[model samples]
Target chain A: MLLKTTLIRLLTTAVTLFGVAVVVFVLVRVAPGNPIAMMLPPGATEADIAALEALYGFDKSLPEQFVIWLGGVLQGDFGTSITLRRPVDELVLSRLPATLELSIMALVIAVALGTAIAVIGARRRGTATEVGLDLSSGAVLSVPDFLWGLVFVLLFGVLWPVLSISGRIDPQIEVDFTSNFYTFEGLLRGRLDVVQSTLSHMLMPALALALPLAAMIAQLLKQNLKEVLLQDYTTLARVRGFSETSVILREALRNALLPTLTLVGVQFTFLIGGTVIVERIFSYEGLGNMAIDAVINRDLPLIQGIVLLFAALFIVINLLVDLSYTLLNPRLRHG
Target chain B: MTGSQTHPNTLDVMQLNIALPNGHRLLRDVSLSLRPGEVRVLVGESGAGKSMIGKAVLGILPQNLKVTEGEILLEGQHLNAMTPWTRRKTVAQSAALIPQDPLTALNPARRIGPQITDPLVRIHGWSRTKARETALALLDRVHIRDPKRVMESYPHELSGGMRQRVLIAAAFAPSPRLIVADEPTTALDVTVQKQILRLIRELQQETATAVLFVTHDMGVVAKVSQQVTVLFAGKVMEDAPTERIFTDPRHPYTRALIAATPSYADLDRPFSPVPQALIAELQDDIVRDDARHQGGAR
Candidate 1:
């Protein structure tokens, strides 16, 4: 049963991704702008425009152009970026590490703090502490992440000025990065200084992005935990002489976490997509930051590449969530 | 330690009153005692506070309800007088609950082995190996066909009867002096309920554990309990030896309950529910009693 579901999920993911690629391709073209016009200087002639369009296969019909792009994409080519004159796949891949690092950091922060606060709130349910948590989390959730990023910049960047507010890392920290994943490569090389710089720069933007997501997680998880705590098993655990902490942690938490995981998975996909504005705010050169540049410059291939990567990421994360659901829930596993 | 000459009752609940925050009493002046090796059933219809009594004794009552006036003694220890932590520790060391709704009474994510052994190891300070062995023995004793496999299995893998049996094994594993079997068989099929009741009875007798069995089924009470406490709206309608409860019930509510129970042997007997008039009269009497009690307090 597990194998069958996984095979079906894989097939659906392929179909969904193909649908996304086609939509993105058609939609980007349909928008009122010619990539070649946007690329050339204001004084360029019609001949120059026609030559550029023909060179990039833009002169052909939409279906013919789609076939050409699709055939190139099948063989690891995502076309050349009209703006940077670089391969779109190369540009997206180069920027991927920064986004992944930031997203993973934000998610870790969100899960840890969110789960901790939720546990505290659930344990002290109906007390003043729980009310305070509800109100504070509500307040946190009311604001969008980009606003949080600006506030973070004001508080930690302009005011206190203890941590780095802009960029992936300090240019002064000279370390040989073996791969684009600077933090991982630095850690592997035992160069803590490079890793430290990467983290210090990541902290503010990541937290800004994480705070709202954390609040969302806390609210959903706390509510789930409250309900689970009232289950007969939790009461039975108490009757068995288990401590309140044990009852909550051991019995209630596992039951509560399943629904929270679903929420986290969906929210995580959005969080990655949300990084577009947040990355710009921190001047962090992640895919989302590059995505904005691609849009402004009408870098069609780059935009298509980044959007497709994000779509693939969304599908993969959702698939992972489904797989973990089966793994975590014994009922699903056995059934 | 008096060589069994004079053993203290396993559990003692005196004038236990559980009330909601709005001063609505859920259990009114309830009292009972259970000697070691005794199985006393608290019999009542739904909302009659039968299960509430069991929860009260085990210190697992709902947070919305408070034990306003009560004292519970477990093996002569004054549970009400102790500090909260101490009370919890004392209760944990001696008491267990076999809960209603077997489906929801075991954590679904956990394997049965850890679920059963955790209390033994944590509360009783037994080693993992010893607890595992004891759990295995108890599971086999409950006639679980494959104890080893069931131990590794999650609660969802087991049938309702199987889960209830697993719970019974867990409850008895620690050899707790007091076990509150709160409708353990209520969620099972009819045939399964009988087997579960028999298993509980066998285990209770073998371990000499005092069981406070809560049920609305008169048949279960008759089959399992030596003494019966019949409750109606938190008030005790009758308390007597099981023989007298069956043969010569004094309260009108008790007679109505007995008459309401359908008997397979006498299929011709008309099933009569507790009369509405009697319920109204009982409610009126309870209101007067509550008013008097409040007035006296003032």
Candidate 2:
């Protein structure tokens, strides 16, 4: 049975990724602007456009072009970008690490900050502290994430200048692209300055993305933890002389957090969605910025590659969250 | 030590008055006492304040309810007068509770071994190995044939009777002087309930730990308890030795409760519910008492 379910998940992921690729390819072809117009300078002749089209094989019929593109994708070649003049795979690969770093950092912030507030509110339920946290989290949850991105940029970039808001690193420093992830590459090469610079640049964008997600997580945790606190096991913990901390953290939190995992999984989808505008606002060179540039220039190959990759990332994250259900609940695990 | 002939009253509850947040007095001047190895059953229908007595003793009462006037003395220690932390410490060392809903009473995420032996490790400062051994011994005492497998299994992996037995073992881990078993078998099947009750009674007799078994089932009270208290609308309608209460119940409420109880021997006998007139009178007294308390506060 387990093997059957495992095979089903793998099959579904592959099918869905193929569907996303087809959708992206169709949308790009149907859109108004041709890639050749955007490829050449403004006053270039029609001959120049035709030559470029022939070079990229876009002059072929749409079906033939699709088959050629599909063949390249099947063979692990994402093709070259019409706008950037580099391999689509290389461009996405360079930006993939940055996007992952930003999302991971934001998610860490969200879970940590949200859990601390949730614990405080749950412990002192009905008190002013709980009420205040609830009100504040509700307010933050209501605001759009892009506005948070703007607010954070103004506060950190203009007012305090506490950290750098944009780009992966200071341009002046000669940096090696060992892993494309500056922090990982820096640590690998024993360069503290590079790691520091990469992290400082990451802090704002990650925070901008995390604040709304954190507020969302806190609200769910508070509500669910309140109910779990009243469960018989919680009372049993107290009756057995376990400390209040032990009761809440070990017993109550596991039961309470079970319900909130669904909300956390949903919030992750929103976090991935919010990355486009957030990366643009902070001038961070992640997949979000790459996607926008591809769209503007009608770079079909680059757009197709990035969208498929995003779909794959999204599916993988959902799979992870689903697997985590077994960990958080023993009944599900044993079954 | 289990058979030591100490004074009869191991736990003393005197003049306990608990009120709701709305100033609705629930338990008015309630009191009871227990002797070592004795079982006192608090019997009442739902919402009759039967479990409230158990909650007050454990200090695990709901936040909305407060014990305004009461003293719960365990082995001459004043549980009511102590600070919350101190009361918790004193209670943990000398008392325990076996809760309702056997399925939910044990944490599902935990193995049966750590959960049963946690008090020994945390409160008694026993080593992990010692706790495991004690836990295994406890499983044997509870008639769980395969001690090693039961120890490693989660609560959901066991039957209802098995889970209740695990909880019963945990309750007696510290050899508590008093155990508040608040309808510990209410959620189980009839046969499982009988087995759980028998196990609890056998363990209580063996360890000489007093048990305040809360239940509405007379069959259960008859099987497990030495004495019984019949509560009706927050009042103790009858208190007597178990057999005597069964044979010569004096209160009208007690008579109604027994008549209302369904018996297997007599299927044609009509099960009569408590009369509305009596319930009205009890509710009226509560309203009057609530007004009086409000007036006194003013």
Candidate 3:
């Protein structure tokens, strides 16, 4: 029964993804000026535009274009980027690692900071500690990611000069496997100094992106923990002589993780969107930077591919969230 | 009195008074003592402070409740004087509570075995294997048909009756000296209620564990209790052996309560409500007595 249900959900998700792809494709194509015109120069003749349009298959009907594009996508051909003149797969894959690293770091920071603040706030509910947590989380959420990035840049980059102001790494650093400096290739050589510098450079942007997400998660966890704390099992645990911290962490928090898990999944999707502005502010060469560049250059295939990647990510994340519900709740697993 | 046998008392609540934050007293100098192998039932109406007494004995009162004036002695030791930590280890070891709502009482996310063995591991420092063995035995004692299956099941998987039985098993896992069961079978069907009550009685007898059973149902009180304390508006109106109380209730409120109870013979007769005037009089008397007692104690 469980396997059947999971298969059904997967099939439904696939249909939903296809629907989303169709809508995004048509909406991007029909929004305004043609992709062919955007690629042409100012004094181009009608014949020149028509030839280019036919060459790129822009002259075909919308449905035909959709089928062709989807077929190519299914065949592992996402088409070539008009701006970079490179294959969309190569461009996306090249930027994928940097984006994943930044997102994973931001997520780790969010979970750790959010959980700590939430636990402390829950333990000291109705006290000054709770008030302080509420105020700070609210303040952090109010400040946008770009503003936060700029503030950190001003502090660490301008005032103290402890970190670089712009760009991912120092241009002067050489790419090698041994030397320790501020470059990714240098870290591949087991260079601890290079790893350190790269981490320092990424830290501010990562924090800038994580603060709002952390605040949102902390608010969710604190409320959930408080409600679970009032449950009878917590009382029973207390009467059973379990210490306060053990009951809170083992019993209360474990039950609270279900909601937090769902929230974290959603936050992950938001992080992709949030990183766009943060990347622009910090000039970090992540997927968000590539996305912005694609939009500016009106690279249709590149934009479509990135959107598809994000949608696929969202679908996988939701599936994992659904599966985790079974792991966290045994009743669901057995029943 | 001097030559009387020196039997060990499992629990002693002396001149206990509990007041709610709403300026109403829940328990009024209601004292009771349980011997090593006794089942004492606190029987009254829904708001008669029976469960309040149970909470006070276990030191698990909800927030906004104050003990006001009282002493709870467990195994001849002062429970009120011990620190919460020491009290948690020793006093809690001596007593456990089977709450009214078994569905919410056990952690839904946890397996039944771990929930039952938590106290054994935390308080007694038992190994996991030992705790598991004890938990299975307890499940068996509570008449769980398949102890192994029950151990693996979560609370949500069990029926209401099964969950209550599981809770009973957990309460008995530590072999506590006293078990305060507050309306354990109230949420089950009539047949399941009988089964739960019978299981509780049999387990108490086998373990020689004293039970402070709280219920509004006089039928349940008659079935399991050796002695009965009748509470009206948070005060003990009468205290005696169960048979004697059923046959010859001395307190007026106790008499009205018994008369109000539906029986097999009275099922055909139109159900009658206890007069509001009498309930009001009882409430006034309890308040007056509470104030007088408070003044005298102070």
Candidate 4:
């Protein structure tokens, strides 16, 4: 039954992704400037524009172009980028690491900070401490991610100069992928200085990205934990001599985790969208930057590939969230 | 009420009064004494504070509602004097509460075994394996068929009766000195109610645990209680042995309550008239008493 349900969910996700792909494809196409026109220089000849259109298959009928694009997409051919003159897949892959790293770090920070604040707020419910935390988190949440990024940039990058301004690493550092600076593999090699440098560079951008998500998650978790605290089982746990912390953490928090998991899944997807602003602010070479460049240069293949990648990421995250629901709640699993 | 001399086998409540924050007394200066191995039923109307008495004994009252001039002594030790942590441990080890809503009384998300074994682990420091064994044994004792399966099931998976039985097993897990069951079988069917009541009675007899059973049903009072305390709007209007209270109730409210109770012989007849005016008067008195107590405490 679990396997069947999971399969159904996966199939639904695939259908949803297909719908997203269609919408992205049409929306990107309907937007103002033609890619061939954008690619041409000022006062270019009609022959030059025509040759570029034919080369990029823009001269074909819309439906035919869509069919050819879709077919190539199914067979893993995402076409070539007009701006970079490289395969769209290669560009997406190269940029994916930085975004992925930043997102994972931000999610970690969000989960940790959000859960701590929520748990503290819930435990100190109706107190000034709780109220203060709640208000601050709410304030943080109301501000947009871009504004938060700018604020952090001003505070840390400009005002204090505690951290460097741009990129995943300092341009002066000549670190190999084999070393422990750029990748997870490198961090495991006991190279603390490289790891420290990488973290220091990533910290501000990650915090900027995570702050809003953390505040939102804290609000979500606080509500859930408060509700869980009122459950009879919590009372029973108390009467059974379980300490306040143990009851709250082990019983109430565990039960409350389902809703928080759903929120985390949503936040993760939003993180992908928010990455555009974060990457821009930090000058990080990620998919969001690639997508922006593609949009500016009117590179259709790059845009399509980035959109598809994002849709796929969203679908996978959503699937994982659904599966986690069953894992957290045994009743759902058995039922 | 005169204090009963402390004995090895009695749970005693002296001058127990529970006042709600709204200046309404749910349990007045009500007092009762139950011998170990004895079942004492507190019979009252829906809002007569019978459940409040149970909560007070368990020291699990809702936030901000003071005990207000009360002493709960279990075998001569003051329950209210102990630190909350110590009190909770003592309660878990020597006292258990079968809350009114059995379906909700157990944790919905947790399996039955761990919930039942929680006290064993927390109070007795039993290993998980030993606790599980004890839980299974207790489930069997409660006559739960397929104890292992029931142990593995969550509260929502079980029927109302099954959940009630699971709660009963959990309550009785610690071999408590006292058990305060607040409407233990109120949510179950008539047959299941009888079975649950029977299980409580059997457990009480075997464990020599004093049971302060709270219920609105006089029939349940007759079935389980040896002594009965009749409360109307929080005050103990009538207190007597169960047979005496049933046969010849002293208080007008007690008589009216008994009259209102549907009997098997009166299947064709409607319920007897309840004097709402008299109940209202008693409730007013309870409120007035509550105000006076609050003022006195201040």
- Candidates in descending DockQ order: 1, 2, 3, 4
Residue B188 lDDT in candidate 1: 84
Better of 1 and 4 by DockQ: 1
Q: lDDT tens digits, residues A1-335, model 2?
A: 89999999999998998888888888899989988887688999989988898999989988898889989999999999887889999899889998988888889899888988999898888899999999999998888877988888799889988888788778877786667888887888889998888888888888888888899888889888888888898898887777777788988888888878888887887897788988998888999998998898899899999998899899988888888988888889744
DockQ of each: 0.82, 0.74, 0.61, 0.55
lDDT of each: 0.90, 0.86, 0.84, 0.83
Evaluated on CA atoms against the true complex, candidate 4 attains a DockQ of: 0.55
Residue B250 displacement (Å), model 3:
1.2
Candidate 1 residue runs with Cα over 4 Å from true position? A1-7, B1-6
- What's the lDDT for residue B266 in model 4? 70
Tens digits of lDDT, candidate 4, B188-225: 89888999999999988988888999999988998998
lDDT of 4 by residue, A176-265 (tens): 674222656447766566667768887888888899999998998999999988877788777777777788887898788888998899
lDDT tens digits by residue: candidate 1, B1-298:
2114368788888899999999888899999999888999999999999998888778888889999997898888998898878888898888888888999988989999999999888888999999999999989999999899999998878899989989899888888999998888878899898899999998888888999999999999889999999999999989899999999999999999999999999999877989999999999999998999788768
> Model 2: residues >4 Å from true position, as ranges?
A172-174, A188-190, B1-8, B272-298
Native contacts kept, each candidate: 0.92, 0.75, 0.73, 0.53
lDDT of 4 at B147: 97
Per-residue lDDT of candidate 3, residues A1-335 (tens digit): 87898899889988987988888888788777567777888899999999998888889999999899999999999999987889998888777666777777788899999999999998888789999999999999999878889999999988988876566666665545432223455555676665666677678888988999899989999999999998988988887888777888989987898889989988888887788888888888777899998887778889999888878878887788788888997767755
* 2 versus 4: better DockQ goes to: 2
Least well predicted 10-residue stretch by lDDT in candidate 2 chain A: A170-179
Top candidate on lDDT is 1
Task: Tell me, by DockQ, which candidate is best.
Answer: 1
